[model samples]
Target: MKAKTIFIVIVTVLLTIFLMDNKDAVDFNFIFVDDVPVSKLAVIGICILIGFVLGFLVGRPRKTYSSYNDEIEDNYPTEQPKSTLSDEDRDYIS
Candidate 1:
């Protein structure tokens, strides 16, 4: 099997075991509420879902000044920035 398939299978088995072990109802506390009876599985699943969502939001790609300018220049061909260095400086760099 592919590595991805193997990993998914392992993860699924572990998650199933975890759910089975945590099937009991427990008193859960929230910021505004106190001692709410909720399933352990639901509590853990909700926390995991929140973590995944926050991770995706934090890790999503963002465009910087240069990349935004590049996209605009590629689409519109506006006045591109040119080098202002003297030939001596260019030769030194080379």
Candidate 2:
């Protein structure tokens, strides 16, 4: 399996074990609410989901935009770069 798959599996297993061990209810306090009775599993699962979403948003690649007035050099050359090759290497390529 891929590294990402393996990591997800391990994390999921760990989370499952943690949730199973902490099944009791606790008081969850939010911005507008008082001590609301909620399961520890729910609170922990929500926190984990929010963390994953935030991590994905922060780590995801973004496109860079250039303005029309800005001067930018051509980073990608159309011509192939020249490489110095030995006689044996050239012969092998041909």
Clash statistics: count for each candidate: 0, 0
User: What TM-score would candidate 2 get against the native?
Assistant: 0.63
lDDT of 1 by residue, 20-86 (tens): 7998999988999999999999988888779879999999998666777688768885776788999
Report the poorest 10 consecutive residues by lDDT, candidate 2. Answer: 67-76
Q: Cα lDDT for residue 54, model 1?
A: 99
Error of 1 at 19 (Å): 1.7
Q: Residue pairs in steric clash, candidate 1?
A: none
**Candidate 1 vs. true structure, TM-score:** 0.57
The digit string of per-residue lDDT tens for model 2 on 26-79 reads 998889999999999888888889999999999998976764434333555567
